[model samples]
Target chain A: MASFLRKNRPLLVTLLIVAAVLLWMTNRYEPKVTASILLSGLTLGALYFLVASGLSLIFGLMDVLNFAHGTLFMIGAYIGFTAYANPRLILNTLPFALALLGGAQAGRWLGGLLPARFKQRWQDSSFLVLTFLLALALLFIGVRGFNLEKLVAATATATGGVVATDLAQEAAGRFLPRIILLAVSGLFLGLGLSRVGTAEVRQRPRWTSAGVGLILVAAAFALIPIRTPGEVFLLSVSSNVRFVLALVIGLLAGAGLGALIESSLIRPLYGRVYYQLLLTLGLSYVGGELVKSVWGTVGFYMDIPAFFGGSGDNCPSPNLWSWFSDHCQSINVLGRPFPSYRLFIIALGLAMFIAIALLLQRTRLGIIIRAGVQDSEMVQALGINVRRVFTLVFAIGCGLAAVGGVAAAPFLGVNLGLGLEVQLQGFIAVVIGGMGNYVGSAVGALLVGLARAFGDQLVLSGIHLPWMDGVVRMSPSIARASTVLIMALVLLLRPAGLFGKKD
Target chain B: MTNILEVNAIHTFIGQFHILEGVSLTVPQGSITALLGRNGAGKTTTLRSIMGLNPPREGTILYAGEPIQGKTAYQIATRGIGYVPEYRAIFRALTVEENLRIAERSKGDLAKRGDLIFELFPDLKRFYRLPGGQLSGGQQQMLAIARALVPENQLLLVDEPSEGLAPIIIEAIVAALRQLAAHATVLLVEQNFRMASQLADRYYIVDDGQTVSSGQMADLVKDRPLIAKYLGAGYAGAGLVPAQSTTA
Candidate 1:
């Protein structure tokens, strides 16, 4: 039993803390409010987890302290927000894409109809020629016939799309072309992808497929029906598609930015701690300033998609799916209405945690990474490219931070100060969890999130004690301060952190 | 025999301290060459310089007649030179199997090497799933040697294999080295002159970061005063122990 305790002390301590927090919450608040707060806390924790996981991973593998992690997060949020705000781009790009699709189909048809005596190269050449002709036709259509303003005006006039009642019809009319265009682009995209696939096997140039994809994207962009009020902000687009697209783009953007930073800035100064710290701190400021210059000083409200937002008489969220619409309203857990979005966020966090765990534990690359974390020189001597693994780990760490930023955008809104604030919390979480420990970072993040929620929400005004007059106050400052307090307490108790191995 | 490795007048520095000054050495192909020296004699530095870990400021390291001085450690390793450092730098957190797996350049060679390693040190196979940190000192030394061999390396640079081991463990290690020398060229550095003369065909004595002596091990055995002059009187006594025991 003592041996067991020694082996799993971190796990047991964490469970105990969680249980204590839960008990305290249950005793103080009503079941419904407690549930709501718990969900919110979990959701918040998940966001912190996303950010902290990357920080821990990079710190563990590379031994580089990344202060600029938050900047990547902000960048991801901005990218996702920008993508989500632009439904018009998707809608506009649709009509011009028809020819590209038709061209690929035509190429396939020609390939099938060609004489059996023709050589494989000749058939392939014919296919290429047909695709090129169709692309040319698309270019013509884009340059001459495609006028997004005229198309929008025409749709508005013909469909009587003025009031909110006809808005759905107008949207339907706008989306129909988008759907068709998507299908067309998708078809050509598939053809291009297949070419790439064949090139991999045959050692052929995959440029033709790439060219097809570029043309398709260009055609799609040419058809975008510009909207004045709608395309300017994230709140303008309430569609689930826009939200999903934004999230994916945000993750990729974050990952890309991470790769860029690692290759350009961090690569040369791998083992130098002071230089890395100075460079990363300077980068954070530069990145924050760059964001401010581009997006301006004003904060943009992160609009929760209709499917994920509150649905009431004041602003009844109009979801295409009735199942989502049904669940969009607050879920009653005693008498209080608990936001389901928080629950969804919590679920996302759990999924991400499991995914990262599986990635680190299951894959051969992960095993190599883990070994590298322990003794990098040995791994290198073993003939593994430890430098490449370092880059990959750093990028992944930064990408996860970006995921946190984008995920938290709806709750916190997009602002210039967002990065620094989240980064400070992430650092605190790292300290609380233990430096260079992944699981500790996650546990620390959840604790911070829970403490913040409970600190702000749990009030002692109603309860009356027989022994003495009792009152406890809660404030927003207290909520923020709670993270610092928890970190201090954890440090006092376990200097190496709960899970940190003694160096 | 053709020389597999040639270190030509290499100068190495570690943070303002000149560790190796004009250190030159050669290891012939498919032969065990021993580097003999006292503590802090730059023997380890010489091996590290050859591996490109502390790439010499001035000099060239030619492995298989290709210039490898400017190459990275992994590049040097991938080119068929394996290194077992003095400390036995094993990934202590990883399992014995994982340590071997990470060292392997090609997965296809694992089973063949695994068989050879198990045959050499059966204790490694018994604790295959155990973390390297949990292993005894001798086992760690064995694991370190086994790791270097996993990549099917042509040359092996072993530093202080018998540094701190019991007579029985050292006996096993000496036997393993004899078996391994049949397949790959070995550059061994040893404080134990007894083990060194037993395993090595040739000897290069390094003193003050320079190669002080280089000759056949047979000649090194004959010249006790020469060994005493370079490796200290204790090492000379240890080196000629087998011969004295045979006479007895």
Candidate 2:
């Protein structure tokens, strides 16, 4: 018994602490309030886990501390919001996408036409510069060509002067020819870029990739009918389907952006930690500003899907078990009404955790990742291309963060500050749990979430200590600082974090 | 025999420190050529250079008659060369099975060599499910060598496999390498001159990042003065001659 206690001291201590907290909470507040607070804490923890898992995995494999990870989250929320509310905004921008693609392809073709001597001397830089110039010219022409006043007037006339969020759909049907042009340009661009990316590795890019891209573009065009009287707007689709579409679009956008950043920015700066930190930090700020410009400065709440029932304060059932049969904005949990979406967030977090764990444990790719974390050079010597793996891992990490953003959009509301806010908490959780340990990050996130929730409660209703006569009151700022305090305390006791190994 | 690997006047550097100034050597096909050198004599660096880990800046490495100096480590490894780094360098957190699985160049490579690996190092089979860190030092060295063999590499670079093992373990390793040499070429780095003389058919002595001498192992065993000069006086006095007949 003594040996067992000594061996499982940490686990025992954690259980003891949890019991003490629960006992203290039940004494101070009603069970319903306590249950609600704990559920909320779990919801927050789910969001943090979604962000931190990817952060931890990326850091473990690449030794890169990505400051722009939060930016990916912000982008996810914006993309999801756009997909949910105004997908036509994206479809309308295809011409601009085509212009950029055309410019890039033109630059590549020009580079290919260059003499071998000149090409060898300049390498791909000249092509990149030419691409940049051509893209700038295209952007200038596109801006000059787009008459916004005429578009707004046309939209107003089409919508009978009652312009709504779905205004862009009115113009979508006219861009069919442009869509075909974009698809063709995208095919050539995809082929050329794949060649550039895999030339060093000597991998031949299969036609299936281009075929898939074309099919997807064609499918998107088919799915959303071309300005038919009844089926013109994507918003006409069910809200739940749109929400699912948002999730998919957000994930793809985040992954694509991640791959681009890794191949272009992070690849050249490997082994230069400070430079990478600087670059990513600068990118986060740029990303935040870009989001503000695109989505506007003010935050907005996304409407709950119809599957969860219409948004209102009406409660038909008071029993927690009734949630399974009834669809309501809020569900009764232990006599307290809690947002059912928060429960969904909690479920998503747990699901993501299990999925990530399975991916890391059961797959062949997982073995390579675990081995790469220990010694990448040795992994490379074993015949695996670590660079491609790095890019793939980075993309996966960003995709996970984006998923978190989409999940958080309904509960927390979409905003520019959301990314950085969750990112800070995610970093704290990672530090507290132990850098590069995903399970530890999850636990750390839960701890932080619980601390924040309880701290907020304490500030609202001052805690009464057994030793003290009166209720001990403190400033509300203490609640905000509670996570840092817990982090500091954990660091003081276990410097490498709860799960981190000492170097 | 035709050379499988030839290093010509390679100059290697690790973060601006010139480690291998003018190291050069050639390994004949199907032979276990031992690289004999003292500590910090760039013997390990020479192996790393051929593996394209720390690629040499001023030399050409011809592998199977093709230059591979500018290639990445993975690219060179895919060309059928395997490396067993000094001190094992096994992924400690991973299981023994996982370590071998990650080293496989093609799918089912491990399954193809499972019998051969277990036949050579039966202890690895016993510890297949256990983490590499849980294994003993000698077991880790076995796992590391076993990892290199999973890909059916044409050439194997074994660096200081006997560095931290007992005499019994070293004997087992030497026997395994003797068997391995019949199927693949090997470039072995060893401080144990006796082990080198026993397993190797030819030997090269590296001192101060340069190959000072090259000859048959029998000739090297006879040259006590050369051993005393390049290796320390301690090695020469420690009965550096082979205890048994050298492997062909």
Candidate 3:
């Protein structure tokens, strides 16, 4: 691991900081509570994996950066829900399956329907414009007629003149819209990943699928709207920062997502970096607007899952909002009670992560995927239609991302900017993981996750340092500043991402 | 005679360099015609154009007497013509068996014509387990010839079979070409005058994408200048008629 770190200097620096911060955060001694916090992290990471995987597969196979991958993912969700109108059906497994299949078929059809000039137009820089069109189309169609529910009619009508709405932030994030959005997202994730067998994508990444399944189970519970009881777990003796843990975990999660997105999508698009960046920006705008269209833009409200809900309390679980509701901790050196529940969620997240690792390494499918990833031609010569494999891999990747979204939505509250917000973090994770390396990607995800958590806490503890943007002169924000700064530094110090071997 | 393969003044351009400039050739019914040329000659380009892997910028390629210039490689391959590239372009990752399977003309192999290939190249039977990448130089040459034997026992475009092979293997290949000519029309591209003179029934010596020399095998073997200028050697001891071998 140390040698691995040395080879991946940028990843190393990130890992050390992240690990140190996680250790520091946990030092508060919320023993029983750490599990749930980790679980929360894992859930969030899973969703990132879904999107990152698709982007990764596309980039690896086609040598094209899908700047609008997130938008496509989001579109899958919309199409799925369009097929199945029941909000409750999105919650049920059978309905979700049907919708997911429908959505994936739509994606495949759309994929095939892409201009016959795909070889020429899709290969050039102008491809970004196409992505922008796709994103814009999805947002316009998805958001405008979401409540209209006439499925084909709304999507096909094209010119359902924009509803004159003066609604802003506080007015949007409501009950019905949030539920609909959640179902749409789940269906999208499932559909995106449905290509495992059909697409022959990267030889069926097993770990990602298993991890996705586990995450789905967790999300199903989260989406249950059912009440569950909880108990106070073991306490610690440290009088340290409880809120500090919350802020740290939040910021770190954000940073990791940012990193993963950058490397998987943004990094490889450097040749057409302008197009990718522009596409990301355009898609992000669409995503934000879509969110605004759903709820009214105030604050999202969803019933907490039984796992997070308090014991027999009418109101859902009550713990610090910082980390996921894992357990309460004994440490409080900084004046706030350490969040035991959120810490537990993080622990769950870690366990979920281990599942992902085991799935990637120990499976036959994984072996085939590894071979295909290295040299697809070698695998294709074996009579496997590699194109189908690519499609499956992309779908699986997208599924993992959707799982992450559903799992994280409870804590972060799914918003329009949520995909883009975490998009950069995912890119950061890719850099941390090392470019295109599976183990590297996981390691990178962890390091960036912990780093962001630490950086956020560090900033709050009387650190008045102004951070730089990714480039020397670029502007920066507290939330985005550290991630971009770290990425820029990593890129400069080592061209290959920290954990990545030189290709 | 019904010409099995015909190239009518075909021209080809790779990027900017004009290579196949109005070159034409014909393989008479069931005859082994040698496409002889020096290095940097357009023999390879002509084969490529005829196979439709590289389309002629201006001209027509008639196969079994049909215009097949603009067809895809697979389309051409499907239409009873098998091309063995100069580089021995075997699917390297595939085992020798798999490579054969891919090339095994699904439609044509059913007829006992394929048995003739195994009889000709029994060495392929011995090293059948090995991957195409692991084959020795001689074995690969045999495999390249065997690969063309598929598709259809109709028209085989064997490019430079005696190229860089040992004399022993060349002799074996010569014997196989002798057998092959009985069933299929053979278009053999060769630099080795001795091998071409022994196997080919007719000669079309191409240089710089133009047919520089053309005649019967008897005529080509007797003309010492033809041998010296085009083939780099002369028929000394053996009479041109006796050396004809009647092999191809």
Candidate 4:
């Protein structure tokens, strides 16, 4: 029992700190308002955890200082904006394109019925021809039937005329020529990516499916008018459905981008860590600039689909979802009402944390990855491809960042600098928690979030007391610097971070 | 026997420091080759170079008649060469079973060899679920060797396996090596002359990042002056020479 206490002392201390904070808060403010503030803090902490978990994992396994992680989060927000805004259109088009490819496969299967002598030629030419025809058919239907040009025009007009004009002009200038080029490139890229599954590629059973998925992602973008008013495309999608689809798209895009970056840029820079750090820092800027170029500098106020209220008195309750409204409406703690969306975000964060924990602890891949973190050469000598593990870990980390971005989009709005604040919070969380320790990152994120929330509500704000004539006040900068102060104290006391190994 | 691995006068540099200059050796198929030298004699560097951990800047390493100096460590490892580092670089956070499990290429193959491994090191089975860091020094060495054994490797590079081990444990490791040598070729680096001479078929003596001598282990044992010249004074009491192995 003593040993158990010794083993979990850090956890106990953290709990004590949390309890003390809560007790102090309840004493100072109205119970309901404090509860609301605490809930807001937890939601923010959860979002930070989602982002920091990825940064921690990637750094732990690969020793990569991925400064571009926040950039990936920003990209995820944009992906959410593009794909989630019109979930119905993208989701519908996805199946149609897949079915067309499936039909092409059916044509190939039918070709298998031909004479044995013609088998080679049929495979070589007939399959390509069938896919090409189907692709052309998809293009025709997508462009003419969907009125892609008008969609582009409407989206441009709705947002700002300048960025849309540039996008449309660029598309119009190279639409035909670019489509042909993209189709060829997409074909090659698909074929190349398919070959990466070496042993499975030799079996060739899933090659067509792999090819279809790759081609759809790589070439399908060309068919959609770049300037399509996102909301118009999303008109038919239900709120819940739109959010889920957007989350999925954001995750996949972030993961894909991470994979590409790791494989191409980060992989080569292994064993040379400072270079990796510099390159990623440069990439973060590049990524931010690229987003600004496309999306413009203005913040896009995300449409709160499921939520009932906007930021005005017209809607009294900020509890947007029906589920929250029905369940939590009557449970006002003091003089203030608690928003349920923050609670939902907290739950989402916990779910993600559990999923990742299960993934790392319960699976064969997790064991290999954990072992690889300690001795990659030993893992390699054991014949496990350590590089592949590194890539996968990096991708998973980026995907989590995307999840954070999408989840926060409704609350914060999608903007050019979306990743900056979250990224800084994530870094501080990682540092305070312990570099490379997952649970530490989560704990750090919560502490940082709560600190900020408390700072906003209690510390920096001018506090009025009944006994005192004047209000007590602190500088805004002190509140902002509190995150760094916590980190500095942790570093000075426990340099390896709260849970870091004393290497 | 035909050579399984041939290092052709390779020069390896670790940063600005030239570690292995013009070092060369050969391990024949179905035989153990001992690379013996005094402390800091580029023995570990040679092993590391062959494993592609610190690749050679000059010359070549031919494994199974193909040049492998340019390949990454994992690529070299996958091509049927297994490495055990001098420090017993086991995953300390992982369990004994997990350490071996990660090294295994095929699950079925590991299952087949699992019983055989336990038969060799019964203590491993006793602490199968314990973390590698919690293991004693002897057990860690055993675990490191056991991890390398899981993959179906044709060539095994075992570095200083006897380092920091009791004579009794060293005997157990030597016996394990003999059993291992039946299926795969072994390239061993050892400071203990008694063990290296007994276990190795051939010997290569390295001095100042260069191969100074090469012969059958039996012939090497008779060369008192050569042994004294390279192995330092610590081995002189072991009766290899009247003088120390090295002046330093």
Of the candidates shown, which would achieve the greatest TM-score relative to the real structure? 2
- What is the lDDT for B9 in model 3? 90
Q: Residue A116 error for model 1, in Å?
A: 54
Error of 2 at B77 (Å): 1.1
lDDT of 1 by residue, A44-117 (tens): 78888888888888988888889999898887777666566533332443344444454444334333443556
lDDT of 1 by residue, B93-192 (tens): 7789887877767766768788899999999999999999999999999999998888889999999999889877888898899999887999999999
lDDT minimum window of 10 residues, candidate 4 chain A: A194-203
The C-alpha TM-scores of every prediction are 0.78, 0.90, 0.49, 0.81
Candidate 4: regions farther than 4 A off: A86-174, A183-234, A307-335, A459-471, B239-248
Chain A TM-score of prediction number 1:
0.69
Can you list each candidate's DockQ?
Answer: 0.27, 0.68, 0.05, 0.33
For candidate 2, lDDT tens digit of each residue in A1-503? 99999755654665687689979898889998899879888998899988888899899999899999888998898778766765545545544454434433343444445566764544456664443454445445434434333332332133232244354443454545445544444434432443353233323324443344444665546634543333245656688888888888888878877887887678878889999999999999999998876666777677777656534444634654665566677887777778887888889899989998898899988888888888999999998989889999899899989988988887778888889888998999998888998788898888878877888888988978789999989999897699998889878988878778787
Candidate 3 stretches greater than 4 Å from native: A1-70, A77-503, B104-153, B160-184, B191-198, B221-224, B227-248
Best by lDDT: 2
Worst 10 residues of 4 chain B by lDDT: B239-248
Candidate 1 CAPRI classification by DockQ? acceptable
Higher-ranked by lDDT: 1 or 2: 2
Tens-place lDDT digits, model 4, residues B144-171 = 8887878788999999999999978888
Point out where model 2 deviates above 4 Å. Answer: A1-12, A94-116, A124-131, A142-233, A310-321, A467-469, B239-248
How do these models rank on TM-score, best leading?
A: 2, 4, 1, 3
- Model 4: colliding residue pairs: A86-A234, A155-A229, A308-A320, B232-B245, B232-B246, B233-B244, B233-B245
